[model samples]
Target chain A: MKLSKLAMVTVAAAMVGGTPALADLVFPSLSYRTGPYAAGGIPFADGYADYFTLLNERDGGINGVEARVLECETGYNTQKGVECYESTKGEGSLLYQPLSTGITYQLIPKATADGIPVHSMGYGRTSAANGKIFSHVFNYPGTYWDAASIIVNHILDENGGDVKGKKIALVYHNSAYGKEPIRTLEELAKKHGYELTLIPVDHPGQEQKSQWLQIRRERPDYVLMWGWGVMNQVAIKEAANIRFPMENFIGVWWSASENDVLPAGEGANGYKAVTFHGVGSDFPVFDDIKKHVVDTGKAAGAGDQIGTVLYNRGLYAAMLAAEAARTAQALHNTKDLTPAQMRDGMEALKIDAARLEELGLPGFGPEINVSCENHGGPGLGAIQQWNASDGTWTLINDFGPADRAVIDPLIMEDSLAFAKENNIPERCN
Target chain B: MSPDFLNFIETVLNGLMTGVMYSLVALGFVLIFKASGIFNFAQGVMALFAALTLVGLQTGQVPFAHLINAVLGTDVHHWGPGLPTVLAILVTMLVMIALAFLIEKVVLKHLVNQEPIILFMATIGLAYFLEGTGDLMWGADVKALDVGLPSGGSFWWEDVTRNWAPAGSDYFGMYIDTLDVSAAIIAVVLVVALTLFSQYTATGRALRAVADDHQAALSVGISLRSIWVIVWSIAGFVALVAGIMWGAKSGVQFSLSLIALKALPVLILGGFTSIPGAIVGGLIIGVGEKLAEAYVGPLVGGAVENWFAYMVALAFLLFRPQGLYGEKIIERI
Candidate 1:
């Protein structure tokens, strides 16, 4: 309590970026480089920063306008994140990538009021998929609901569509980020007739002997984890110790990273996690990144961390943001654009296979389309397995689309409520 | 053995091991409090700093890489090759001792005659300062500390125990990490060494004199300042051991500092000045919480590990406010 966390955040915010640019886009990266989650946060921050660096270094900046990359550390705390938003929102900041569900939920209202978009990207309020009511917030390319649906479907597919009396356990981090998939899982369980076991692990879940003991006792048929950071590593290690079938354990995209599984050693082999994009550094985009940024000695982080799974996800998020800016520039025919204009560009942004190829990232991720009604892009993801011996991941299943039947109505219901509460007109059409 | 009985035994064993880890941290607090009468809230952060320094030294990671890079416009990650494990540990010990001395001289010296609450608040500030300093020194990613400590399941123990267990019992013969076993052994050695050093050594007698009465110790020609420095250094050493155990267990990260909060309830149950009380209190809390999580946790949707220890401390305190082994206070004022 020496310095109020808000005060520290505000001071840290001013330290991020101060130079005003009239002909450039401003995107403040609300980053967490120091926290319990920093192990996961570092790569994402590095990748996000690196992508912007590459854009500026190689392409002479996005749409020929020098882009300003402001990195204000949030330490993964929600209130500090808001303080960061408050401190930096006035510096022509167009969008924010909070990378935390708690922060995203807190900023939804503020960003909506300020007319700047919040890009949560694959995480956050799943109902933010509805662009109409949540016009300023986007989790495009995927959402937590999409991940839940895809994971449940993958489980059903694995069990030959017959989990009539089977037990499925969700060992999730005990937070809004982890609890997000619960309702979706319950709905899927109702459909699949499977018994669901919810085991909540508190934040920074390092001690889980009792939870694992319970799992060993109950012997759930499948263990679906909604874990992040140290929790994922600990859970995987515990599961391996208890001799749980690693194949049957599926984690959300957050749980699938080298940092998460590598610590468990070979015991984590065959562990599976659903991901929305291709993993590894073998993609063509990495070559361009290496040639222009990393090899040119302009990389934002250690060269070794260039293309890890989380790193790639972060890079992809930055690309999407930059693409939105580019799209805005093309449509408006101007280099200087405001946050409002950027919002319009986000609404009309598209990144198809051709565009991915053009960006030197063919087959990197699924094609995504953003619109007024569908802020969440094509919600498709694949399952990847960990070859723990060799320390690499391989996609084990083809892309599976999220169940729109289950998710669309849920989004409609939640977003409509939000719109009503805020006295905003629905813009579904 | 019956499977239920075996499971109970396993839970107790696990709890005791966890309790030992907590006591390892609680011991540092006890040492400093007994000698200096300062409730050091930054003890956990001290452990974190020790571990970070250990890893940074081991890996030859340059201290203040980000700051150095920003200031000098150079992306320097390392100075050269890493040191051997033993050398790095020794260097880390030196760093911690120097830290203890520096803290005593700079921060602790200014507030010697202050009230315990004031000292406690000062320690909180120290905690924040040390935590921020640790992050700034080592850039905040969870670093793996490999002192060649054994990790993963101890299959030999499981294999041997499974031979005696009854057939068809789903008993996996108790899964315990080898790292935890190593830590428990190290902690036992550390406690024994501490006790012997205190009982049979000159510095130990001086520490005891300081603990007894500062003015009496000063009258007896024992430099209270030197004793304070010695005790803080010993506490720093204890924090290093605790840090290594935890950092190895769950990676060297920020949450390692939060483990101090867990040790707080232990200190409550153990009393501030009794080392033995720390051990006993930690075991009680660890066992109580684990068993509660196993039995009572399910009824309440689980996750009782968070508050069960504090609840135990609170319930224990209702009767004996001075704690189990605490010296009774005779107030005349």
Candidate 2:
């Protein structure tokens, strides 16, 4: 009993001293390394971990304040993610990136109230991109709504600048993340005089013969996929079997990955997807990773996988977390910072080409500047196509702004209406 | 007189195809139950495993040569130089037979006299084990299993005009998926093959006698252990066929086990011991629940289609306690 009491006292002492002694920013990573979604989740999580490790090792940490990442496996469940958030939120958490849309939705209110920021890059309630209703929630780069608009624009561009009377089918996973894009597509259909059909595939998405059989019967002009995990590969293969032109099919960012395409081989060729980030080993950031991290043996498992698509996404997320920390430290004028201070830092953070080059990524992508009223400022995305012969994804187009003259007012109006209904205060811009 | 009616009819037709797919899975559940008293809850996982194995073999994930070396102790990976689809299937059937033998010896043999429910729970454990094993062996990616089935459809006058019918007509014209139609035909063939083997073969007769009275069959010089092995082997084959149809339809993934769950309602609706009843029960439940969901789902929420099948079967149980074709029970005090 005396020993137990001593242990408890020691732990308490460690907690008190550890915060300032570490002198590093903490970003709690709620990962799902084991689940039905693990196949997709593992790569993303690995990338996230390695990038932070790289920063600490190669670049001497973010502004000399070492970045510390604590990974807690949540298995992609909302309840577990919430538990992870609560447990870790106390230990100087800079921000929370739940990855799961359901958990993101649940945390938005709590995080907003607590003054903690939630960075749901590319996957969350697309509506939460509305800075007025969802002040603390930041879904940057682009939302699902923006993705849908860009995809529609790409389709029309491919079909000679008209989509009137064309039929498009959305084969999506039956989840909040998958369904988020439907509102945008429905609105676009009404505006452009096209027909939209939605077909929802149940979770884990292994069985789609029936869904595709419906596709075969209906014979839509194009198919838009909003699937994740195993569903993406299945959809591609099914489309191939039914002789649907791969070029006519477009997948959201999550649906296009090496894991999704490699399993299908030749069958997945010519399948184009709207990608937000460029993928390949050509970037200078990847070169530094190979030399400083992988070669020096400081890298994690699969070090050879330095520049895969999901790996780069992970790097981007880590970069964002580190940048937020740097901003927080600078703003607060102290290395030892709180979650609230870190959130403010995130809002004030700006990542430009100079910062990217300093980190060894020469012009990796665009500069992002976050503000009070603008979460996803100047939303831009690229397009990539799968090349089965070379076994790689090739960039087909550079980042183009989503036809915002069409999407902006719609986003603003809907955001205002949502804020009024939910009793959320507008951002102090 | 509204587009809502047209949409409802279209949904019903879609539901019927879904029901047909569920019935194919149910057919496998019925097959095992007819021969053995144990309800095989792992049948859906068995289908998933089989389909994943097939895709794995074709994609060189599980090299044919490696399988041949493991089983037959021969280097035959390059043998026959890319076997035709038909030959690959035949080879897979042989592999399934070996797998059945292994399963009967390793798993079913240990729990021979356990209660049916206990055996059912064992199969559920087996289901989880197999799903994990299959995913680990074949890298948890979705693979399209195109078993050369046609996927085209045609619209008849009834199909075209059924949406124009009165609100309460309950008539949604048939628009069958060619895949479903083919699956139904294959299921019938499987049932007939199983029936002929059980009725005419000597081993089959011995198995049936064991099913009737275990002690009497033992006295009459029949081997219960061998009979159990044979029964399990047949069930495994049935699971493979079910897997091919299902895998071809959806893509082979671990989620195929949920499709196996649909068989429970089929078992409840049909007598657990009756083969014909299992098939008919599957069809009735499939068509009835799907029709209900299509016609009735929008009134509540859209997810009524998920639970409506089980609900209809539950209601049926209240009226007919022994199930639709269960044997009449005569209890003696």
Candidate 3:
């Protein structure tokens, strides 16, 4: 009877074109590998899949339970993202990493209702970091608000702790992701005594003649950007064209990829961006990925994306999820885990300096400690500058702290408002 | 000059340059519409594909490397050293010409004598197919197009204009991109070349005959299929030039296709049947939108440029449906 059941299971799996077995841990990657933003999305998806492949190959499927990445293309469309989520959530999907902020916003409430944890990483609704209100969503390691605060702190450090009467301009993509830092920056402006200018770039951001011309006319002391995909590249080129001092212009983490800078050639030199993790292929984990995944012909997409900025971010996200799963396994003492179990694992997860060192990434990222109340980790980040000649990004500072004094109240206000509107009861006791 | 006046002058100059860029894409649309009367929605995608092909050839990247690797489990990215920029461009032009032939034979040929809307739908389908095929041929990474085009601000112009302002004024200098200037020059050259060809060449006369009336031209010795292939090939070459300029400016990527939308207002303003109309319309829309965004956007929360062109087009549509230079429409009672 057992032999016949095994045969029947194998046949069923074969009939499905060799889909992952139902028993494996499922991580659905809602990726956009086509459309305007595909330049950024392709590497990220490759990195996400390759990291999971590494876990399965090198570690024998995360402590004897295999992991499967079910990727669905969203083309960066929010509607398609929801469809991908709905389609893949039934495959025992433990977590979701919807890279697009728009898709993450759409998936937050639905994934919450479905009891699936979403890890938005560096991008998403800022208030989702307040785990008390957003129970199933986590934007750990850093949030947009945290990045905003961190950038302000860096600027303050550069200016000898004073920016009174200084004009600081923000050139942002006119979307939810771009609008995220406005409130925080306004608050920071009130505290620091700097004049604020807001410039919104529409989707795709291919043309910015008027905005850059305005920048030239106004001549602000510094510029901050919240852009993604083609917007980043175009903005950098335009900034270079207007002779905007490259060092004075900084981008959010999403805007700091190789794809963004490489298009500008030497013009992108000295461009700075906030980063939560280390860049390049100097990390030891890439060695194992090469041995087990790329060389073995099990890599995702093209193998050329192993060391890119977004790729590293995707790998970092997968690393966090795997660590959380291992933590859940230890807590429950079981190899087979459910979605709820995965949520519990993510909540109780902690990665310290020692743990990072052991994971073959000694200084790859900040120490993440997720909890019931604080889902956004320590909110730490650093600055990375582009060296156009060598085609490399050098981290300019160590992981510094975000201004929690200003950030916490705003988070509280936003989370409480969200809780009241959604009628969600605060969870963590 | 007053600082405010200098700023206005700067804005206008930049707008004109931006308009020239829009006109480059609009010319392709005008060519197809003038000849075939099919609103080729795929013009933007054609530019994107042409640019992608140029970059792929320049970098010597193996076509369909991803698909091949997936199916055969083989790692093959590049065959050998890349071709020179000029050689790659020539090869890309040939590829685009071949693509034009294939499109005429496979898509446009079957839809002959069909309604304009049907042909338009076919072009839409062709656009999507071409976009997908381009992605498969060249990986979707953003590749920098280096045709040795000098970009950044014109320092000489800036230095000359810096002293135009009063001694105490905060205005540093007028900002103008050298690449935009190059694009303007190239666009003028393209327009002149197109005009000379249409006026002097036999094929160009044949093209003009078809544009006058497709059925009438078919009644004569003109082969409508051959005219389409030729016009499309010319449009394809125009797309290659536009793609190179744009791809150089913003890097060759998918958003290059969205530029076709920017040309829509130009088409509406400049009658779609006139090449010079496209250029003039592009300039009007470009300057009008830039000035609107600069002077009025701040008062109304900014980002008005994205919609300002459409508003101008809408006004033109309501007042003069045929546009500034479009052939006057006369309907029989």
Best by lDDT: 3
Model 3 earns a TM-score of 0.96
Point to the candidate with the largest TM-score: 3
CAPRI-style docking class of model 1 based on DockQ: acceptable
- What tens-digit string does per-residue lDDT give for candidate 1 at A340-362? 88988899999898999898788
lDDT of 2 by residue, B1-333 (tens): 454555455545555555556656766666566556777878887777777777666655544343344456443433233445565566666766776677778888888888888888888888778777775566554565666776534345346666576767654443445666677677778778877887999987887787777789989999777777677667767777777876665566555555667677777787776767777777777666555544554355333444666787788789986678876678999
Q: TM-score each candidate.
A: 0.92, 0.78, 0.96
| Model 2 docking category | incorrect
Model 3 residue runs over 4 Å out of place are A1-22, B72-74
So what's the TM-score on candidate 1? 0.92
Record all residue pairs in model 3 with backbone atoms less than 3 Å apart, i.e. clashing. none
TM-score of chain A of 3: 0.95
Candidate 1 residue A89 Cα shift, in angstroms, is 1.4
Ten-residue segment with the worst summed lDDT in candidate 2 chain A?
A: A297-306
What does each candidate score in C-alpha RMSD?
A: 7.0, 7.3, 3.3
